[model samples]
Target chain A: MIPTISVFEHSPDRGQGLARDMSVRWAFEEVGQAYEVRQVSLSAIKQPAHQALHPFGQIPTYEEGDLALFESGAIVLHIAEHHVGLLPADPNGRARAIMWMFAALSTVEPPIVQREIAMYMEHDKTWYEKRLPLLEDGIRVRLHQLSSRLGKADWLEEAFSAGDLMMVQVLRRLKTSSVLGEFPNLCAYITRGEARPAFKRAYDAQLAAFIGKPPKQAN
Target chain B: MIPTISVFEHSPDRGQGLARDMSVRWAFEEVGQAYEVRQVSLSAIKQPAHQALHPFGQIPTYEEGDLALFESGAIVLHIAEHHVGLLPADPNGRARAIMWMFAALSTVEPPIVQREIAMYMEHDKTWYEKRLPLLEDGIRVRLHQLSSRLGKADWLEEAFSAGDLMMVQVLRRLKTSSVLGEFPNLCAYITRGEARPAFKRAYDAQLAAFIGKPPKQAN
Candidate 1:
C-alpha cells in the first residue's frame, strides 16, 4: 500500500512551502515516490485520531500500513532510508549525511524558529527591538559558521544527499530575513538546491495547494 | 582506536549534566562502549581545528576513525545504531524509536532552549516578565501532549529505545522549571531514566569533571 502523510488543511505559511509538510513532500519527490496526503484542520489535529498518529499533534506524519511516524525530519529520513536516491551508498557517507540532518534541525533551525516566534508573538512587546537584534545575531553566528563550512563546496559533503535536502530547507526559512543575502555562496548553494528538479516538483506541488491547483494525486 | 567525543572544558552547566555531552556519555554507557573525551574551551572551539571537527563549533562532537560527527542527537543516534542496546531490532520499532528522537529534539527541545535563552540573555530586558510566561506556556503545550501520550507508561514505547533516551534527556532540561512539577507522569519518566545504572555512571563521569575526580580511562 502507498504511504499517507498529513498536511495542514490551510497552512499558516500560505503555501510558501515553509510548512513542515513540504520537507516530507520534497523527500517523496526526490525519491520518485507517489504518496497520499491527509489534510488536517488545526482544531482537528488536536483531536484523538490525529493525536494517535502524531503525539505532538502536528504535521506532517507518515503512515504506511502499521507504521505511523511523526516529525518531519523523521518522515524525511524514513523516505531517504527506504529510498535509494536520497542517501549515499557508503556507510560513512550515509552517517555524515544523517549528521547534517541533525545539525540542520537541532542546531540551525532553532534560532530561526525562535526569531519567528519572537516576531509573531512578541512583536508588540516593549523588548521587541532589543530582543530582535539578539535573535538575528544568533542566526548570524550559525550562518557564519555554516558559511565557512560550505565555502566552495556544492553540497555539504561529497554528493547531494538527505543532509543537503534538510540543510537547504532549513536555510530557506531565512529567506525572509535579510541576513541570508549577506552570504553570497550560501545563497548560491540554496539556489543550486532549488534548481533541482525534485525541489521544483516539491515547491510547485505545495504552492499548488494555495493557488487551488494542487497536482493530481498518484493514487 | 576507540572514539573520542568533545566536551566543554568548563561547562556553564557545571556538574548538573545539562550539557549536551551528557546525552552522548549516557548513550555510551547504555551501550557499554569505551570512548575518550576531548575537552574544548569556549575560545578553543572557535578555532580552525575544532571548527574542522564541528562546523558549528560546538561541544560533544564524535571522532571515530576517519569519521567525525557533531550534534548530540546524531552522536547518540550513531551509538544507538552501532550498538544493540539502544535500539529495537525490528525495523518498524526502530523507526518509531528514531521518530521519538526527532520529536524530542525538533518539537520538544526548541521551546525549552528558547526559555533558557530568554532567561540567560533577556532576563534584564523589560519584557522578560511579559515574555517568560509565553515561553513557558509553549513548553507546557508540548509537555501536556507528551504527558497524555505517555500516561502511566514506563517508557514511550514497549521498550526503552534511543527515542526514550533522547526524550528523557530533553525533558531533563526543565528540571529547574516550576512547570515540570505540574506533570507527575513526566517527572516519574525522567526519574526512571535517571535511575538507570548507565545514567548514574554517565552522571558521575561528567560530574567528576567539575569536582576534578575524572574517571580512569578504559583505554
Candidate 2:
C-alpha cells in the first residue's frame, strides 16, 4: 500500500509551495515514490483524530501501515532512509547530509520564521517598523553563513540530498523579502533547487491542491 | 577512538545547561559512550577550520575518524542511531523517537529562541514589556499541547527515548520563564528526564566545563 501523507485543504501559503508538505512531496517525487495526500482543514487539524497523529496539531504527517510519523524533517528523513535518492549511501556523507537538514530547520529557519511572525502576527504593533530590521539582520546572519558554505557548490554537499531540499525550502520562505537576494550565490543556490524536475512536479502538485481551494482566512 | 564533540569554551549560558551542547552531552551519557570535548571560544568558532566542520560555526560538532557532523539535533540523532539506550530497536518506535527529536528542535525550540532573542536583544526597548506577554503566550500554546499529550504519562511514549532527551532540554530553556510552571505535567516530565542518571552526568560534565572560566560576554 502507498504511504499516506496529510496536507492542508486550503494552504495558508496560497500555492506558493512554502508549506512543509511541499518538501515531503518533493522528496517522494525525487525518490519516484507514489503516495496519497489526505487534505485536512485548519479546524479538523486540531481535532482529536488529527491530534493523535500529530501532537502539535500541525500538518504533513506520514503513515505507512503500523508506523506513523510527524514533523516534516523527520518525515523527509524517513522517506530518504527508505529511498535512495534523498540521502547518500556513504556513512559520513549521509551524516553530513542529515546535519544540513538540522541546520536548515533549527539554525536557518527560526530567524526567518521570526520575521514571518512579525509580518503576519505583529505587523500592527508599534514596534513592527522598528523591529523589522533586526529580524532581517537575523536572517542575513544565517544567509551569509549558508552562502559562504554554498560557495560555488551545486548543492550543500556533493549532490542534492535532502539537506539541500530542506535548505532550499527554508530559503524559499524569504522570497517575499529582499534579505535573501543580497547574497547572489544563495539566490542562485535556491534557483538550482527550484530548477530540479522533481521539485517542479511537487510544486505543481501543491499548486494544484491550492486551485479551487477557498483562500484560507487563518493560519 | 572516542568521538570528539566541540562546545563553547565560555558558554554564554554560564553553565545553566541551556546551550545545545548540553543535550548532546546528555545523549552520550545516556548511551554510555565516552566522548571527548574540544572547547571552542567564540572567536575560534568562526575560523576556517571550525567552519569546515560546522558551516554555521556553531558548537557541538561530532568528529570521529573520517566522519564530521554538525548541528546538535543531528549529533544527538547520530549518537542515538549508533547507541542502544537512546532509541528503540523496533522500527516504528525508533521513527517516532526521531520524530520527537525533530519536533523538539524544529517546532518547540523556535518560539523559545524567539523569546530569548526578544528578551536579550530588545529588553531595553519600550515594546519589551508589551511584547513579553505575547512571547510568553506563544510558549504557553506549545506547552499546553505538550502537557495535554503527555497527561500523567512518565514519558512521551512507552519508554524514555531520545525524544524525552530532546524535549527535556528544550523545556529546560524555559526554566527562567514562568511559562513552564503553567503546565505541571510538562514540568514533571522534565523533572523525570533530569532524574535519569545519564542526564545528571551530562549536566555535571557541562557544568564542570564552565568552572573558573570568565563569563562569556557575547552570545
Candidate 3:
C-alpha cells in the first residue's frame, strides 16, 4: 500500500523545498517508493483532526494503514528503515546513520531555526542588529565543526545514507544566508546532495505542488 | 560487557537531571541495564579523542562494544530499540513511540530552550523583555496542543514507552518556569513520570554524579 504524507498546501518557502515535507519526500524518492501527498493549510492544521494525527499539528505526517506518524525526522526515518537504499545493512552502520538524523534535527537545525525566527519575526525589534550576529556565531560554530568532520569525505559516514540526506536538508536552509558559504566543503556538500537524481525528483515534486501540476521527472 | 556513557563532569544544570545524560540514564534503568559512567569536562569534550566519538562533542554518548553513538535522542532511542521495556513489540506502536521522541526533541523542546537561552544569555539585552513573551507564547502553543492530546490519558500512547520518557524530561525543563504550571493535566502527567521507580533511579544516579556518591537503587 502506498503511504500518504501531509504537506503544506501553500508552502511558506515558495516551493524552495525547505518545508519539512521535502525531507520525507526526498527519502521516499531516494528509496524509489511511490507515495501520495495530502496538502493541509495553516488554518486547518490547528484543527482537532489534524492535531489528532500530529500533537503539534505540524506537517509531513506519514499515514500507512493503521500507522500514523508525524515529526519529519521520524517519518523520514520510517521510510529509510522500511526501504533498502536509505539505510545501510549493517546494524552498527545503521545505528550511526540514525544518530546523524537526530544530530541534524536536534543539534544543527535548532540554531539555524533560531536564526530564522530572529530574522523573519524580530527584524524590526530593537535587538535585531545586535542579536543577529550572536545567532550567526552559533551557526558558524556548528558549520565549522561539521566542516571539520566532513573534511574530504563524500558523506558524514561511509555511504550517502539518510544521514547525509538529513544533514544536507538542514544545511540547505543556510543558503539564503551567507553562513553556509563560509565553509566551502559544506557548500560543495550541499551541491552534491542536490545533484542526486532522487533529490532532483523530490525537489521537482515539491516545486510542482505550488504550480498545481504533476511533478517533472529528473533528467 | 556493560555499556559506558559519557556525561558532563560538571553538568551545566547542576544536579537537577536536566542534562541529556539523565534521559539515557533513565532509559538504562527502565531496561534494567547496568552501565558505567565516564565523566568528561567541557574542555575535554572538544578534544580530538572525544570528538571522534561525538562529532558535536556532547553527552551522553553510548558505547557498547564496537557500537558508539551520540545525540541524546539517538542514544535514548537506541536504548529503547534494543530493550523490551522501552519500545512496544508491535510495529505501529513502535513507530508512534519514536514519533513522540522526535516531537519531544524537535517540536516541543526548541522554544523552551530558546526561552532558556534568552533568560540566561540575553537577559541583559534591550529586547529581552519584549522577546520573552513571544518565546513563551511559542512554548504555550506546544504545551496546549500536547495537553489536549494527552487529556485523560496515562501516557501519550497506550503504554509508557520511551516517548513519554523523552517528553517528561523535556517538560521537566520548564519546571523552573511557571509555564508548565499553566497546564494542569500536563503537570500531573509530569508528576506521574517522576513517580516512576525507574525515573527515581535515573534521577538519583545523575544527582549522585554531582556529589561523588553511588546512585540510589530503585525499590
Highest lDDT scorer: 3
Pairs in clash, predicted candidate 2: none
The C-alpha stretches of model 1 lying farther than 4 A from their native spots are A214-219, B216-219
| Model 3 C-alpha lDDT per residue in residues B129-166, reported as the tens digit of each score | 98889999999999999999999999999999999999
lDDT of 1 by residue, B93-195 (tens): 9999999999999999999998998899888877788888999999999999999999999999999989998999999999999999999999999999999
Worst 10 residues of 3 chain B by lDDT: B210-219
Compose the digit string of candidate 2's lDDT tens values, residues A83-142: 889899998889989999999999999999999999999999999999999989988898
lDDT of each: 0.90, 0.89, 0.91
- What DockQ values do the models have? 0.88, 0.84, 0.85
Candidate 1's docking class is high
> What TM-score describes the B chain of model 1?
0.97
* Chain A TM-score vs. truth, each candidate: 0.97, 0.96, 0.97
Report the C-alpha displacement of residue A203, candidate 3, in angstroms: 0.4
> After best superposition, candidate 3 residue B204: deviation in angstroms?
0.8
The sequence of per-residue lDDT tens digits that candidate 3 reaches over residues A94-176 is 99999999999999999999999988898998889999999999999899889999999989999999999999999999999
Better of 2 and 3 by DockQ: 3
Candidate 2, residue A141: Cα displacement in angstroms equals 0.4
What value does DockQ give for candidate 3? 0.85
Per-residue alpha-carbon lDDT of model 1 for A49-149, expressed as tens digits?
Answer: 99999988889989899999999999888899998988899888989999999999999999999899888988887778888889999999999999999
Quote the positional error of residue B86 for candidate 1 in Å: 0.8
